[model samples]
Target chain A: MIEVKNLVKTYGDKRAVAGISFKANDGEILGFLGPNGAGKSTTMNILTGYLSSTSGEAYINGHDILEDPIAAKREIGYLPEFPPLYLDMTVKEYLYFVYELRGCRLPRNTHLKEICELVKIDNVYNRRINNLSKGYKQRVGLAQALVGNPNVLILDEPTVGLDPKQIIEIRTLIKKLGKNHTVILSSHILSEVQAVCDRIVVINQGKIVADDTADNLSRELTADHKLIARIDGPKDEVIKLVQTIPGVVSIVADMQRERGVWEYNIEAVEGTDIRRELNRRLMSRNWYILGLRSSELSLEDIFLKLTMGESVNEFLADKADDLEERYKEEE
Target chain B: MNAILKREIRAYFDSLIGYIYITAFFAGSGILFSVSSLQYGSTDMSGMYSGLFYILLVLIPILTMRTLSEEKRQKTDQLLLTAPISLTSLVLGKFVAAMLIYSIGVCMTIVYATVVSFFGAVSWLTVFGNVVGLLLLGAAYIAVGMLISSLTENQVIAAIGGFAAMLVLYLISAIATIIPVDWIARIFTELSFAERYSPFTYGVFDFSNVLFFISATVIFLFLTIRVLERRRWS
Candidate 1:
């Protein structure tokens, strides 16, 4: 387990990490989501005792990283953004060196055998690290971190430059590792974090904006009900009819998907379900209701909304206005 | 500390830098022995070690250039510093590893001493004094190079800086002669490592000179540790 309290890292005039704090519980996968240069790496570095924070405390298993680094570091296995590997050494040599360097009390042969198997790097164990592919090099880096079997793993952008197949492989490995070790993974890739992390902490400009589960974050950020309806009716008449319905906040007609069919996105009052009433109204008006469905903000939308600090309704309004302006130009 | 020492030693041999350094060092010492003792047909090895002193001006840089600089350039310091070992032990581990390699190279010069003894009577005490002096002086030089290496990530800069620093220390006695004042000249001469080491080459193992070499090595090693600690703050 790890805990950071009001951690601040300032580089002279600029602050790289400005008073941010979060925790990764035991056997949990905590994703640090942020754009590039959002202090994610800085936070990870401070946690791993690689870089000192300007102020505040980071504790690993009740030991402060600064005051008691050796004890604190003993509980951590860190893989920096650029894996710290000696390319001249082979994979087995590098991991063995790390094993001895961390002062592992376990039998070296059995311990290394297990790590090589867990990260599935046995095939490249004899090859020089620099001679391997980037994916294999990353696996060796992961193997280095697992040498001592530390309780916590701090991985900074573990899948930054890997190919799609390698990314999925590494993600699967991390998910498997999460069954025992507490993991704090940082990345700018949204879907990667959404796929593997149990809890998400969104950081922006050295500040934590939102901290919740993936589902909880999107659900909490969504404040209004949304519905998409496909109806065979005149566009203007449909818009006017939807506006007349109570609890309907706004309606925008989407581009026609089929001949004589109009799609409209409807925003209703919070906690309101106007789909049934609207469907009945459209049917009574002799408009064929081809499709109707309820919708909510996606994780991508929630991330952009919270980080950009823009209201969803305002964004949609601007988008609709832009579409209408283009239509007028085309006319 | 042991892990770092083993790895550095293994790295040196694996990458062929150890063999190159040892071969280069012995070649330099062989050239010096041929000129100083063999051609002259003298059994005294003091002059040969004196010649070795100059060879060390270049060899020490090569020996220590990659000790810390390569770690920085390759970003391996992140792994080392984040491990459970203390920084003092890390720096000391590197210092001892360099010393061990340098000692092995210096020990090979004993064969020259053995060859000299076959021709005539060679003073074992004189050989002992020069060996001690060489080790002490070489340790100080390695420490200087290690400190310089910690200042930059580029091995070239570290090597050149280390050579320049060693050259200045080697020439301190000569530079002292050009001083205008008596007191200043005396201070420069006292500060000259060459002045301290000259007595040992004459087969005199002065305790003060031994202390001088040791304290210089310790000071520089301490400086290297301070540089490492300061890096974390900056």
Candidate 2:
């Protein structure tokens, strides 16, 4: 378990982490989702007692990192953005050193071997870490963090540089570790978070924007749906008719997907579906309704909207009435 | 602390640093031994022990430059600092490791005394006193170098700064004479480690001088720990 309270870190005139707070329950994998300069790594560093925050406290289990650092640190295993490896040492040597560094009481033979097998680094045990590939190097980094079987694991961008296969392997390994240890994994990759994280906390510009379970976050962010329609009618009339329909917020004409047919994106007010009424109105006007389908928001869109400093409703409104404004806001 | 100490000692032996440092120590002291004992046919080891100050002056920086600087450069300090270990142990572990290598280097030079013993009656008490003096002086120098290493991440800068600082301390007695103010000159002379170390080389087991070298070592090592602890906030 972990708790952070009003953590603030400042560098001269700039705040790297601005009074942000969050918690991860026991055995929960909390994914810290953010883009570059999001203070994700800064938060993780403070939690692990690697860097002191300017004005707040972080606790591991029940021990405060500042008040009782040794006890708090004993409960954590941290893998920084960089692996923090000594390249000259062999993989086995490096892990053993970490074991002793953590002051593990377990027998090194069985425990170290078990960790090596858990992270799938047994084959490269004897090889020097400098000679290892990026994938193996990352695995060794993970293996070191799992030493002493600490209850909490704080990993920052654990799968940043690996190839696709290695990414999946590391994700699977993290998921397995989550069965026992409380994990706080930080990454800008949404898919990685969606795949492995039980709870997601979205941070942007040194602040927390959204925190919820993956399913709940997706549902709440996308309550307002957009519909794509293709109709054989005048663009002006189509826009005017959709505007008059109740619960239809805004409609923007898209490029014609077919010859002599117009495509329009229509956003409906939250908790409303204007599909049935619109279909009837187009039929009454003798305009051919070619097709219509709802396009629900994805996690990527949710992340972009939150990090762009626009609420989901405001983003949807902007997307319907003004495409140019949305693009500008993204920049 | 033991874990860090073991790794640091293994690191020195694993790289070319330990071998080169030991080789240089033997070569430099061998020349001094020949000049003092063989050339003059003297059974006393005071001259040879005096020559040790110069050998340590050149090699102490090389031995301790990487003690903390390399860890900072490679970012491995994250691993050590984040562990359950205290900062004091981390600093002391590295300090002790460098002292171990310097001690072994000094121990190997006892063979020079053995060779001199075959030619004339050598004073074992004098050799023992000088050996203790050499260990204490080397410990103090290593502590200073470790402090310099902790202040910077660049090994070259640590080495150069350590050598410069040691150079000044080594010549402190001579430099004191050029000072115009008598009281200030007296302070420098008293602070000069070479002046305090002169008694041990002459087979005089002055306990105060021994305490002085040990206190200097403890102070520098304590300062290194303070620097590391302050880094967590700044």
Candidate 3:
């Protein structure tokens, strides 16, 4: 278990992580969601006892980070933003060094073999760390963290640059580890977190805006929300007609796809689903309904909402390009 | 602590740094030894001991430049610092590793002393005292160099800084002659290493000199521990 209380971190004049607090239960995989520079890494650094908190305190399994650093550190395994590696040494040598540094008492011969099999990096054990691929390097780093069988594993952006297959493998690995150890993973990829994490904490501007299970936060944030779309007739005419409807508050013609086809996001006044009525109206006008899709508030949309959807184009309607562009701008 | 010490020792031999470091020290000391003991046919073994002191200035940096600086550069300190070990253990481990390199190199030079004793009349007790003093002096300088290595992440800066520091210690011995030997200056001059080491070269055992070298080594090592410990807190 981990407890963070009133944590605040200031870099120079700018406040990076404002006073924020949260806790992760034992044997739970808690996901920390945020855009770039949202104090996710800074919070992980402090929790791992790598950096000192400016005002608050963090306890790892009841050991205060500052007071009992060695004991606290003994229970925690950390993989920072950059994987700490010694390029000159082979993977086997590096892991042995970390194992020894952690003061592991297990007989080295058997313990290292068990760990190698657990992380599944046995084939590349003899290869120099500098020669391994990026995905392999990440695994070596994870293997190092698992050296002492630490109770709490604090990983920051674990699956950032891995390919899709590698990402799934790592996520599966984390899920398996979560059953025995308390894990805290920070990532911008929502589906990845939603797929594996037991609980989720959404932070923005160094503050926890929403903290709950993935499903509960998704359901609560988008209560009674429905997206209505009518395909056919002129989009402007559709907008004008929707305005006459009793519940419709605003109609926006957002896209003009080749020729006469047009689309708009029409929001109703009070979280009402007007898709049935709107579809009937368009059918009566002799307009053919091409397609209409409602945007479900997945963990991705909730992540954007909690982070303050300032630049996320609502008209794009789940377009990944806009999300990627927004992710870059935040960095 | 033993793990880190073993790893550091392995790195020296694995990467050829241990070989290079020892080779350079032996090679440099060999040339000087051949000139003083063999070619000159000098019966004075203590004079050869004086020449060996200069090797400390050059070789100490080679043995210690990468001790902490390379760890920071490669981000390997992340592994060591986060481990359950204390900072004192880490610093002490590296200090012992560097001293091992110095000890190995100095041991090989023993063959020279053996050759000289067979050929000439030399005070074996004085030579033994000189070797002990040399080890103490090398240890004190290694402490200073290791501390400087921990302060910076750049290996080049660490190496140059270590070299410059050793240079200052070397100059401490001659500083009194250039400056006046006055009452105030006299105190600083007496604390210099050369003044302290002079008694041993004359075949006299001085408790004060031995105490001075031991004190210097302990103080610098304490400072090294302090600097590393402070890096963790704030």
Per-candidate DockQ values are: 0.73, 0.73, 0.61
Task: Please give the lDDT score at residue B210 for candidate 2.
Answer: 91
Model 2, range A219-250, lDDT digits (tens) per residue?
A: 66654457888999988788788899999887
In order of TM-score, best first, we have: 1, 2, 3
Is model 2 an incorrect, acceptable, medium or high docking prediction? medium
Residue range A97-164, candidate 3, lDDT tens digits = 88888888778868888878877789999999999988888888888888878999999888876889
How would you encode candidate 2's per-residue C-alpha lDDT over B30-109 as one tens digit per residue? 88888987888887778879988988888999999999999989989989999999999999889889989998889966
Which candidate leads in TM-score? 1
- TM-score: model 3, chain A: 0.79
Task: Output the lDDT of residue A122, model 1.
Answer: 91
RMSD versus native structure for model 1: 4.2
Candidate 3 per-residue lDDT over residues B1-234, each given as its tens digit: 899899889888887879988888788778877777678887566666677677777778777888998887887777777777777898889989989888887776567777777877767787778777778778887887898888888878888999988777667656756676476567767677666766676677788888888888788888877876666545
